[model samples]
Target chain A: MSETKKLMYVNRKAPYGTIYAWESLEVVLIGAAFEQDVSVAFVDDGVYQLCKDQDTTGLGIKNFSATYKALGDYDVNKLYIEKESLEARGLTLDDLMPLVYEDEDDDWAEKDSIKVVSSQEMAELFEQSDVLFNF
Target chain B: MKLSIQVNEGPYNHEASVSALNYTKAALEAGHEIFRVFFYHDGVNNGTRYTTPPQDDINIANSWSELADKHGLDLVVCVAAAQRRGIVDEGEQERNGKDGNNIAPGFRISGLGQLIEAGIQSERLVVFGD
Candidate 1:
């Protein structure tokens, strides 16, 4: 059997006003479909992607944020958020979707689970990954 | 390990530039050398010297330039992409009958060979696109 590939998806843009967020999600879903070990990290304005109260109906745009919730169904459950980003945006864990892991989780609590991390930790994740995709 | 990065989206148009920067930084930090960073499509706009983002916004072009300057990085902007986007050096500007040159320092206008060479030589090649 082929070894599972370690893939990391880095998102650094806002959820709306651009296609990067949606396209990045598409890549992640496809990667998951291949059974690749995938993890997604939201940084900078990308944190907006997990905000709970998004409303895109008024703009006549499809609500791509919902697609994020479906990522888990594809086995893309390793979602990461930069702690500093959330704090900078004045967003707490409660303000985000319930699927995300909180920052207070123990360092090695979940061996293969999604977890919020600091920028320094994110750098390490990038180094450890066999394949890294920036979107 | 050799690595090739293709930047196909312009700075500020999305997070392509930021992600490219972070990826490059991480690769270098992990002791992996970048074989080449090829800027194509709208990515050539990153080499434009006239870009000046607001103070509140991230100046992605400057970030890229600074990274290249610090690492002695090979920053290649596609010639065709630059010409189409009106980003050219002094010689190209003159040749194209353009009045001014907006190509930034530390960025080279080159052909697709750079990208092809990177793909052939690198163990892993990642592309950053819109």
Candidate 2:
């Protein structure tokens, strides 16, 4: 393992419509083993990746939304969703899955996964990333 | 500066690989070190050695192979993406009971981790996709 450099998985596509969102999550899970400082950002249409009440049963696809919830278990807790994207889509924080992680330093406190940020803030996060995986 | 490039589209059908190749050539000409070129999704289709474009069209696979050979570059096609898209190397073909391999010269099939490794080792990770 090398240094724990910051990695950002930029999700700018809608899930299910294409394989990009699903495959991007796969990379995030595999990359977890490397112990890199990984953060997932949902921008553009990518914000839909975390949309709540997703039902893929009718589409003959395995519902992978739960996997996003499980990302916290993999120690990938940082998820940033662009506030502008949500607003443009007429979606609020209520429209997304409730993702959270246990904050051990804060005495095992739970934290929200959706760290909503403005588009400019998202750009800052992008600048901080050593590797930006755009899928 | 050390750089890593990722291509997300296949040859002929899309311009992503072409742009990536051009960017890489310019980078190298400007004395930038390209740590690796990792092809993902449809981009893995660029590694097929069996591609034979018409007399007028450029063969994208050969272009990548030539560029890689010229610079001793690591050209890796994501194995998971490749297998899903029917692109295979010699070992992959044998393991999967396929009859042949279509991996181009100077290109190898690898996992997504190779892309991550390239990202870790390089200063920038540039992506070219549809």
Candidate 3:
């Protein structure tokens, strides 16, 4: 039963404003150990968590945004960023960190982990998941 | 289908609990089996029996207590979170050497393992938070 279920972590808040973003990442890191089919969705202000060059030194935070780059190593690489959210916030994919993983199926080629999906696709993704984690 | 709900925010402070309650009620009305309600973080505050809201407002804790009593749903507050928040049952009070217990009726103090167990046992795990 370990890898049989579809687990989705739905992030709807911005990073740094509250502890939810950091704590959610903590859960994602721990959940990776369970070896489940983990997928993360960046909706609303959640996309900010992956923004490039997050300077948290002034805020006195650890600046854990870089940890998203390592999610591929844990085999939790499916990151769906809502297109509407990004557009509304006037952000493009170029504004975020480049996260890619080696595609084991294709001669160990590289594959991008960040996927820009429509809101409808996001809803379908939610429909297909066994678990919906929002914080 | 069996559904497990995780509430991560405290009552009154956030609409997470209220949304969870509504979604849960809707799920039950739609003939879904609720496996458990796992309260974590400040969410455990929803289980404190001492929460006395004004007459003008709804008592969220009591709402959950009544729902549990009516449907026999398991309402579990995480022990680690509850201990930090001072939400204790009689057993917990005895174990922690505390003078009093404030665990609301129809709710029990448990561990984070209960949340994992729910995820494994139920068909769906729906989380609500701020």
Best by lDDT: 2
The weakest ten consecutive residues by lDDT in model 3 chain B span B111-120
Total colliding residue pairs, candidate 2: 0
Global lDDT scores for all candidate models: 0.77, 0.91, 0.88
TM-score of chain B of 1: 0.94
Output the worst ten-in-a-row residue range by lDDT, candidate 3 chain A. A26-35
Interface C-alpha root-mean-square deviation, candidates in order: 7.9, 0.9, 2.5
Candidate 1 vs 2: which has more lDDT: 2
> What TM-score, over all chains together, does every model reach?
0.53, 0.95, 0.75
Model 2 C-alpha lDDT per residue in residues B6-119, reported as the tens digit of each score:
999998788999999999999999999999999998899999999989989899899999999999999999888898899988899889999888899999998888988888
| Per-residue lDDT of candidate 3, residues B1-130 (tens digit) | 9999999999999999999999999999999999999998789999988889999998999999999999999999988778878999999999999999999999999866677668867977888876
User: Runs in model 3 with CA error above 4 Å?
Assistant: A106-110, B18-32, B54-59, B62-72, B78-120, B126-130
Docking class of 1: incorrect
Rank order by TM-score, top first? 2, 3, 1
Per-residue lDDT of candidate 2, residues A29-117 (tens digit) = 88888888899999989999999999988899878898998998998999999999999999999999999999888897999877999
DockQ category of candidate 3: acceptable
Local error of candidate 2 at residue A97 (angstroms): 1.0
DockQ of each: 0.09, 0.70, 0.33
Better of 1 and 2 by TM-score: 2
Candidate 1: pairs in clash: none
lDDT of 3 at A45: 94
lDDT for model 2 comes to: 0.91
Candidate 2 reaches a DockQ of 0.70
